[model samples]
Target chain A: MTNQLSLQQRIQMAFPGLAAAYSVDGLLHYRVEKSRIPELTQFLHEKARGRLALLFAVDCRPLAEKYEIQYLFAFASDHPWVLLTIELAGQDRLFTSITPSVHAAQWYEREIRDLYGLIPQGHPDLRRLVRHEHWPKGTHPLQKAFPWNKTIGRQQADYRFRHIEGEGVFEVPVGPIHAGIIEPGHFRFSVAGEPIMQLEVRHFWKHRGIEKLFEQQTLSTAIALAERVSGDTTIGHSLAYCQAAETLLHIDVPRRARYLRSLFLELERLHNHLGDVGAICNDTAYALAHAHCSRMKELLLQLNDRLTGSRFLRGAMAIGGVTKDVSAIELSEIVALLDGIEKDFAELESIIFANASLTDRLETTGVLTERTGWDHGVVGVVGRASGIDQDVRRDRPFAAYDEVPVNISLYRYGDVRARLRVRMDEIHESIRLIREIRANIPQGPVAPAAAHRPQPGQWALSAVEGWRGEILYFVMTGEQGSIHRCKVRDPSFVNWPAIQWAVVGNILPDFPLINKSFNLSYAGNDL
Target chain B: MFRILKKSLKTGIVTGQHPHADQPAESPSQAVCEKAMPFRQSLTIREVDTGSCNACEMEMNALANPIYDIERFGVHIAASPRHADALVVTGPVTVNMERALKDVHKQTPDPKLVIALGDCAINCGVFKGSYAVTGPVDRHIPVDVRIPGCPPRPAEILKALEEIRRPASWK
Candidate 1:
C-alpha cells in the first residue's frame, strides 16, 4: 500500500501541472489539463512501461457540463491500475491524439469520434470506425442528445478503401458476407502474384449500437445485454460487468461465489480452445482430428448445460455474486466428465502430432513478429505466441485467480503453430485449474445479502481474462443509481488489427487457415 | 495408417440408424418434412450467421460431430448455396448483412427452404431494439420453420431437421 502511495506521489512530482492526484476506490486517479494528456501518456508508455488498458470518452453534459475522457493504465510489476482523467469543457470539443506514440490508441480515438463526435486532432487515419457511410454525418449516437432508439434512415455512399496500383498488383475483396456460418467482416487484400502486399480489414458491420442500449437499461437488466455482446463470451463479459458494478457499490462477493466464477470461466476456455484446435485441423484437411475434437467440445457443452440451464453459460452471473450455486453432486459430475475428456483429448493430440503434413502447413504460415505485437498491444494467445508474456489473470489478479495461480504458456515463433500450441497448453492449464477449484471449494452463501445501489458520481474499472484475452468494463453511475456510461472492450478489438499485419507476405489461399488460428469474435470486436 | 484402419474396424459402424429406419409415425408437418417422401430423403443445407454472438453457430457445428451426426441422417452442409436445399440462418439480421442475405437467397436454386434457427433469427431475440439490427430473418425472407431457443440444443435442432424431412401427410 505504501509503495502504491509513493508511486502516486512520484507521478504528481513528475507532472506538476496535474490538478489533483489521489487514490479513489483503490485506483489512483490523476486529473490533468487536456493539453498534458499526450505528453503524460507518452511518459507512461516509454519510461514507466505502463500498458494502456482502456481509453474512452464519457458524456457528462447534465452533471458536469463537460465530456470526461479516461485513460486506464496497468503496471506489470505491481499489478496496480491507474486512471488518468481529463475533463474537457463542453465548448472545447477537441483533444490531441496520442496514436503517434501509443499505437494502440488508433482505434479507440477513431471510435470516440464516431460515437461521441469528439475530435482527435492529427489522427493518422480519421475515418468512420463504428458508424457506416450510410449513417448521417454529425449524428453521434453516444451523445446525450441522441436518443437510444433513434433511427437515422440509411443513405448510400462510397466508403473509400485503400488501393494499391502496379503492373501485376490486383485487389481481392473478400466478405462482409462469407460462405460459411461465420460473422460478417470485410477484408481487402492487395496482392501481386501469389504473395499479399498489404491487407486492409473493415469490421463493425455487426455493430448493434450496444453501448447506446446500455444507457437505456438499469443495472440489473444490463447483464443480459452484456451477455449478448458476444455469444461465445457470455460468462466473461457478464462477469466483468458484475465486477464493475460490485466495485462501484463497495460490495464484497462471497468467497464461494468467486470460486464458482473462476470455475465457469475455465469451463468456457476449455470448450472454446478445444473447438479452435479442431477448427485449425479441419482447415488443413484433417477431418478426423476435427471430428474427435468436436466430440470433446460437445461433451463440455453438455456438462455446462447440466450446471447452468443455458449451454452458453448465461444467467449465471449477477451483480455482487453468482445466480446459480454448484452443489456437491454437480461438482462431482464435472470432475467425472473431465476425466473422460482428458483421456480422449490425449489420444486425439497424439494422432494430430503424428501427422507431419499438418504440422508442416502450420509451422511458418502467417507470422506476426513480436515487435508488431508489442507495438499493437495484442492480447491473449496471439500475444503469448509472439513472446509477449502478459496475461490479465496473472498480472492483475481477479476472482479466484489470485488463489489459484495461472501458468502462462509462451512461444517465440509467432506463427500458426505457436498460437495453436498456446491454446493447447492453456486448455490443459484450465483443466488443472478447474480440478483445483473443485477440490478447494469453500462453503458460504453465494449471493450478497442485498444489492447495493451506487451513489452518483462514482466510477470503477473491472478487467476479466476471457477465453480470448482480457475483457475490460468501465462503469459510471448517474443519478438515482442508474448507469450513466458503460464501456466494454473485448480482447478482439485489440487483436483484430494484428491480423492485418500477420497476413502480409503470406499467400492468399492460406488466409482462411491463418484466420481460423486467430478465431477472433466479429460481434465482440464490432460492439 | 494401418493402426487407424484397425481402430476403425474395432469401432465398427458409428453412423446412426435414423436414415435406414422408417419415418416416425407422428412426424410433424413441416416444410422439409412435407417434401421428404421415402424416395427423396437426402438433403443439403447452407448456413449463414448475420450478427450472432456465435453460440448458436457452435450448436450448429456440433450437429456435424459424432454424437448427433446429421450426416447419418443423409444431411450434408453444402459448401455453396447453389447445391443447398435449405438455408439455415442465425442471429438478428444486421443492416450491413441485409444485402448479402438477400443475395444468398437469390443465388440458391428453386424449391429452397429457409430455416430460421435460434430466437435471434426468429424475432431478433435479445437484440430486438438496437438501431443497427434490421430485425428478424422473416422480415427479409419467408421462413418455413422457426426453431426457438437462446440457442437450440443440438438434439432439438436434429429433431426439427428430422421433422422437416418427413412426408407431408405424416402429421
Candidate 2:
C-alpha cells in the first residue's frame, strides 16, 4: 500500500506537465491529457496489474466552446482512478475509441456515442447500443443547452441488429417479455439448434431518463431515485449515491450510523445473493436446493422485516445516517439468524455442487476468459469469477467499511459455476461481516446528514462496493444549494456486455442458469 | 393402488383441513396478516416508473402477496391517473418520461398522496443530472411520502403509505 501511494505520487510529480491530481475522499483522481489517456491507462493496466476495471467517457456541456469527453479509468491496484478529460471541438469530437485498446471500454464508448452524440473515431461494432434509431436530430439530451423540456424520453425501437451470417445460423428472437416474471428486455439469439451462435441483448424497455431527472431534484430526494435504480441492489446503489452526497457535502455521519449503513448494505448482499442462489438452482431444475434456498431466503426476508421494519431492508439507509437505529437486541437476533441461515445455505450448496447433474450444466459453461472479463469491465460476483478481484468494499471502502474488513472472493473459471460460487462465497462473507458488525456495533446519534447542509461547489466522489458490484457516483453542486449535475453509474452498465458474452457456447436451455448466475440488473443499467 | 387406498384409510374424512390435521388450521399471526389493508379509507395510488429497471415492481408485487399483505393498509394501487389519490412512483423520471409523469399528476384527484418509492424515485439518487430523467417524483408530482431504498421493501412501502394517510385517517 505504501509503495502504491508513493509510486502514484512519483507519477503525479513526473506528470506535472501533462496531468494533475484531484483527491475525492481517499481515492485519488489524476486528470491527464486526452492524448495521454491510452498510454496512462496502459501503464495502469499493465503495472497496476488488472486493478484497472472500467473506462467510460462522460460529456460535460460547459458554457465554453469546446465539448468535454472525460474518460474514467479505475484499477484493482488498490489505487484511485485516473480520470482524463479531453476537450473535443469542431470535427474533433471524434477521438480514436479505446475499444481496440481495452475490451471493457466498448459499451461505454457506444453509450457516449448515443448520449453525447460523439462517435469514437474507430470504435468496432459502433451501432446504437441504446437510444434506438430515429432519435430526433440536432439534440443530444446530455449535451448542454439541450433544453430540458425539448427532450422527449420516448421508448422507440430503432434499427435491426447486424446478425452474423452463414448456414444454420438462424435467428432466435425472444422477449420484451419472457415466460418467467422478469423485466422487459429483448434478446436476439443467433443459433444452430440449441447452441447459441451469438446473442444480442436489446435493452431500454424501462429506460426512463433517471440522470436527467437528478439534474433537477434536491440531493435528499434524489436519493430515493438512486435507491430505486435496481430494487434488489437498492442499498448497493444507494450507498454509492449517499456516499457521494455525504462526501460532496463534507458531511460525516455518526460512527454508529456508519456501522448501521454497513449492516444494511451487507444484509442487502445476503438477501440478493441468497435469492440469486435459489434462482440458479431453479434454473438447473434442482427443486430440492431451489425450495430450500427460497425458504432460507424467506426466513432472512422475514427476519429483515422484524429487525428493520422492512422485508428488503429498505428505509433503513438515509443520506448521512440510517433512518432507524438497529437495536442491540435486533443485532443479536440478526447474528443468530445469520448463523442458522449460513448452515442451511451451506448444506444445500454442498448437496447441489456435489451432485453430478448440477455440476455438468454449471461447469465449463459460459466461459468468459480473463481477457474478456477485463475487457467487459464486469463487476461483482461475475467479475470475480472471471478473475477480476474488484470488489468495491475491498478496493474502495465507504461508510464504516474502512473499519470493517471484507473478504473479496475471486476465481478464474469465468463461467456460470464461478459466478454461482462467487455469490455463495460472498454470502458466507456477508454472514461473517454481520457477526463482526453486530459485535462492534457502536452507539451515537444515528442521524447527522440533514443537520449541516453543505456549501455548493464542494464536489466529492464517494463510492461503495455494492452487492452487485462497485457503485460509482459523481456529484457537482452549484454555489447555491441546488445541484448542477450528478452522474450515477451502476456496475450493471459495464457488466451487461459480459451477459452477452455468457450466452456464447451455451445451449439455449442453459441460458436461464447462466443468466441467473450473473443476474445483471436491466433497470439499473437502463437508468 | 393398494398403497393409495391404505393412505386414504388413515384419514377419516375426504374433506379434512390439513397440515393441521393434528390441530387448528391457522397460526395466530396469520389472521391479521391475511386481512386486507386495516384502514377504513383506501389510499388511491398510481405506480409510475420514471426510470427504474423493475426491481421495484418485484417488491410492489410482493405487497399484495399473502406474506407482506400490503392491502392490509387500505392501499390499493390505481391503474389510471384519474382514479388515483396517491402517486406511488418509482424510477428517476428520466427525460422521456417527463411528460407522462406530469400528466399523471395533473389527472389525479385533489389532495393527492404522492410517494417516492425506491432510491430512484426519491432522489434520482445515482442518475442525478443525467440527460434523460426529469424527476425524483417530487419534480413532476408533489410527493407526500418517501420510501427510500432501490426498491423499498413492502414493509417500507406500507409504512410510507401509512404516513401519507395517517393525519387524514386520524381526522
Candidate 3:
C-alpha cells in the first residue's frame, strides 16, 4: 500500500499546477483550476493509470461562493484514491469536458448539466441525463435552492432516439411499461428484420429524486434512504453510505463489525447471483434450471430473514458499524445452510452445463467486446465477463476484504455464457468466503455507542463491490453536521450504456437474455 | 432428464395447501387474514411497479417457487392487464410511471381487484415525501387490497392475493 506522504508527493510531482492538496485516510485530495481539470484528469487517466471511479457535481454555495465538481480516480495497482475537485465561479458555471479523452465522463457531465446546471463546455451529448421533459427548464433539482417536495405539472416532449436511416430499417420502442414484473426503461432498437443494428436506452422512469431526498435527511436516516437505492443491492449501497459516513466521522469500526458486514455482502452476492443465473436460464426456456435456482435463492432469502429482521438485509447497517450481530448458534446454522446450498448448487451446475441446448442459447448471444467494456468503464460481473480484471474487493480492499482475499473470476469471451460462467465462479467463491468468515467469527460489539456528528466541510468517498458492480457513494457534510451533498453512483449507471453495445448484432428475441445477463438495476440507475 | 425426474420425485409435494386447508396455526394479523378468506380460488394478477426498490418484486417472484407455488392455488401472473382479474402494484407512483399505472388500471376489466404490495405502494413507505414521487398507488388509482411491509414476505403476499380472490360476501 502507498503511504499518505508518498502518495501526496507523487500527485504533487505529477500535477505541478495543483493549487492546494491534502490527504485523508490515505486518499489524496487536490484542488485545481477549472480550466486544468480536463488536462489533469487526462494525465491521471493516462499517466497515473487511475480509473475514473466517480464524477459528480456538488452545489456548494452554502459553504463556498461557487459550485464544485469532484472527480474520484482510483489506482487499482497502488490501492489509493485521488479526488480532484474543481470550483466553478460566476453565474454561468462552466468547466472543460473530459469526455473527449475519458469516455466514462459522458453521462456524468450530462448529469451535472441536468441536476446542478453546470455546463461541461465540450461534452458531445448534453441531453438531459436525470431530469425528464417534465422538469421545467432552468430548474435544477440537486441545487440547494430547489425544494425537495416541489412538484411540476406534467409536460410532454418527444425524445429523439438515434435513427439508423437505411433500407428495411424499423424501430421497436419497448417500455417505460414492461410486460414482466420489472422496472421501467425505454429501449429504442433500430433493427433490420431480427438483427439489431442500433440500440438506444432512456431510463430514469423510476427516478424518485434519491439524491435530493438524501439532502433532507440526517446521517442516520440517510442509511434508510441508501438501502432503497436498489433493493437487491441493500447491503452494498447502505454499507457504502455507512463507510463514507464512518470515514468522514473518523470512526474506526470494530473488527467483528467489519467481518459481519463482509459476511452480509457475500450473502447478498450469493442470493443475487443465484437469482440471475436462474433468470438467464428462464429466458432461454430452460425452466427446470430456473426452478431449482429459484428454490435455492428462496432458501437464502429465508436465511437472511432469520438472521436479519428483513429478508433483503435492510436495517443491518449503521453509520459507525452494523446494527445486528450474529450469535454462535445462528452462525453455525448459516454454515450448515451453506453446506446444503453448495451441494444442491453443484448438482444444478452439472445439469446446466450438461444441457447442450441451453448452453447453445447462451453462448455468443450477446457479445460485449473487451474494447467497448474498457472504454465504457464497465465494472463488476459484466466487466469481468468482458475480461476487465477489476474487483473493488480485491483491488481497493474495503471492510474485511483485505483480511480475506477474493479470487477474481474473469472471462474474455464477452458473451452471455461467459457472463453466466463468471457468475457461477463468483457464487462458488462467495460460498467459500462465507465459510471462511463464519469460522473466523470475531468476538466484539457490532457497533460503537451512538454515532457522533461529522465536522462541517468534510468530504469522503466510499466504494463497495456490490453484487452488480462497484457502488460509489460520495458524502460531504455542510452547516451544523448535515449532509451537503450525497451522490450515489451505482454500478448499473455505468453498465447500462454497455448493454446498447452488447445488443447491436444480436436478434430482438435475444435482447431479454442479453439484458438478464447484464441485469442492471433500473432503480439504481434512475436514482 | 431422468436425474431431474428422480430429484423432482425426491422433493415431492412441496407446494402449500393454503386454499384447501387453513395454514398451520400462526397469529394472523386481522388486517391481512380477514381479507384473505374472500379470495380463495381463481385470480389473474397483473403487477405494475411504479417505482419500487425491486425487493417487493423479489418476494413476488418467490411466490411462484416450489414452496410457495401460487399457481397451484389458481393464481397466475398475467402479462396483460386485459386478461388480469387483479392489478398487483408495487412501489410509490413516480411522475414518469403514473401514466402507465393508470393505463394498466383502465385496461383491466370491471370488477377488478387492485392489491398494492409493499409499503411504497401502500403509502409511499420510505419515499413518502420525494418530489419525483406523485404519491402511493392509491392516490392515483383505487386499491382494493394493501399488503404492507418494506416488502412483504412471500407468505404475506400469498395471503393477500388469496384474500382478494375470495367472494365479496366472505370479506
Candidate 4:
C-alpha cells in the first residue's frame, strides 16, 4: 500500500499536469494530457521499471465525448498496475505514436487503428493489423456507431508484405489452411535456400469478432465467451475474465473457491504443457517421446473430465468464483492423477534429455534471443524461456497464487530446448502448486448465489499467466452492468510478431518446431 | 538410445481397440451409395479449421493418442485433401476462411465426404450471428456427417470415424 501510494506520488510529480490519480481494484488509474503519453510511457517503462503489459483503446462515445486509449504498465515487483488513460476528442483520430520509443505498443497501436480507426500518427509500418484484405475500408467495428452484427460487403484491397529481394531469395507462402490439424494462419517466409531471411506471419484467419461479441454479453454470460477465446487456455482466459468481472462488480470470491480456482488453473497448465512437450518432440520426428507424452496428456485430460466434467475445464469457472466444487474423493483422485503424471513425466523428461539426437535437434534451433523477446513484449513461458523473468502468478498474484508461492525456473538459451525446458519446469512447478492447494485448501462455498452489479463506466484489467503466457482481459461496464468493451489480448498477439525474428537465421524446416515451441493460439490472437 | 528403447519396451503396447471394433465391416449405406462414396477399410480424413476455438482441434489431435489410436481403426489423417476420403472441417465458417474452405473442398477428390466436426462447425454454435461468420460448414460446403459437442470427446470422434468407415453400421 505504501509502495502504491509513493508510486502514485512519484508519477504525479513526474508528470506535472497529471489530471487525475486514483486507486481502484489494485490498479492506479492515472489520466494525463494526450500529448504526455509517449513521455509517460518512457518514464513508466524506464525510470519506474515497468513493463507495458497492455495497451488498448476504449470507445467512450455517448457516455463521454471522446475515445479513451488506456496504457497498462505492470512492474516486476509487487506494485499496483499503473493504468494511464489518454482521451481523444470524438472527432480526432490521430495520436502521437509511442512505438518509436516503447516498441511494445507497435501492434496495439495498429490494432487500435484497425478496429477503432484511431491512427497513431507516427507509428512505423502502419499496415492494417486485424483487418484482412476483404474487410471493407473505413469500417471500424469497435466504434459505437458500427453495430456488432452488421454485415459489410467485401472489398478489394492489397496488403504489401515486406519482401526480401536477391538472386537466391525465395518467398514461401504457407497456410490459412495448413497441412496439419491446427488453426489457420498464413506465414510468408523470405528464405535464401534453407535458412530464412525473414518470416512474416499474416494471421487473423480465425478472427470471430470475439471482442465485439463481448459487448453483446452481460457480465454473467461473458465467462463462456471468454473460455472460447483460446480453447487450450480456457481456465486462464475465464479466470482472468472472472477476476476482471469480480473486480468490476466488487464480488468477493469464497476462500475455498480461490484455492479450487488455482487447482483448476494448475490442472489446465499441466495438461497443456504436457501436450506441448510431446508436440515439440513430435515435430523433431521423435515419435517415442510424442507417443508417451500424448499418453500422459490423455490421462491428465481423463482426470480433468472425472474432476470438472470437462476435459478442457470449460464450465469450471464462473464470475464470482468457480462453478463446480471438488469433493474429497475428487481431490484425492486429482492427487493420485498428479502423482502418476509426475512419475511418468519424470521418466519422459529423462528419456527426452538422454536422447542426444533429439537434444541436438532442440538445442540452438529457432533461437529467440532474450533481447528480442523483451523488445517485442513477449510474456509467459516463451518470455521466461528467453530470459525475461516474468510470471503473472508470481509477479501479480491472482487466485490462490497470493497465498501459496510459485517457483519459476528461468532459462536463458531462448531455443527449442530452452522452451521445452521451460514447459518441463512449469509442469513440475504446477504439480507442486497443485499439491500446495490440495494441502491448504479451506472449506467453504464455491460461489455465492447473490448477484452483484457494477457502476456504469467502471473498468478492470485482469491478467493470468496461462499455459502459453499472459492472457489479459480489460473489461469495461456499460449501462445496467452490460459489457461495454472487453479487450482480450492473448499472449499470442505480442509473441506472434516475435516469431518472425526468431526464425530469421533458422532454416525453413525448423519453423514448425519453433512455432510448436511457442504454440501461440491462432483463435486467441485472431480474436 | 537403449534408454528410449527400454522405456518403450517397459511402457509396452497401450493402444486400445477402436469403437465398434467387435463389429465386422458392412456394406456402404444407401445414403453412401447415393453419394457414390463406398465405405472402405481405411478412411483418410483431411482436417480444415474454419474458425474453431481450437478445442475441437485438440480433441481431433487426441484421436491419435494411445487411448484412441484412430490409425489402428484404419482412420488416417491425410496431409492433403486430394488424398483424403473425407474432409473434416471444424468451427463456424468465418468470412476470412470462407474462400479457403471452398478451395479446400474443391481440392478434395471426387466422391469425398465433407464432415462438420464440433458444435461450431455444425451450427455456428456460440459464434452464431456474428458478422464475421458466414455460417455453418453446411452453408459453405455440402456436409455428409455432423459431429456435435463444443468439442466432442475423442471417443465420440472415433465413433464418427467408425460410422464413416462402415456407413452400413450407422443407423
Which number leads on TM-score? 4
Every model's TM-score: 0.95, 0.77, 0.95, 0.96
Off by over 4 Å in 1: A1-10, A24-26, B2-39
Tell me the deviation in Å of residue A111 in model 1.
Answer: 0.9
Q: Scored by Cα lDDT, where does model 4 land?
A: 0.87
Q: Candidate 4 on A150-239: residue-level lDDT in tens?
A: 886799888899998889999999997888899999999998999999888898888889989999999988888889988999999999
- Which regions in candidate 3 have their CA more than 4 angstroms from the true location? A1-14, A450-452, B17-40, B169-171
- CA lDDT, candidate 2, residue A307: 71
Candidate 2 interface RMSD (Å): 6.9
Give stretches of model 4 more than 4 Å off.
Answer: A1-6, B17-29, B33-39, B167-171
Chain B TM-score in each of the candidates: 0.83, 0.70, 0.82, 0.86
CA displacement after TM-score superposition, residue A392 of candidate 2 (Å): 1.9
Give the Cα error of residue A68 in candidate 1, in Å.
1.4
lDDT of 1 by residue, A112-187 (tens): 9998899999899998888888887787989888877676677778788999998999999988767666878999
Select the stronger candidate by DockQ from 1 and 4. 4
Put down candidate 2 lDDT per residue, A309-403, tens digits, no spaces.
56666667777788888788788888988898887676666667767888888899888887877767777778889997777777766667789
lDDT of 4 at A412: 98
Q: Considering the two chains of model 1, state its CAPRI-style docking category.
A: medium
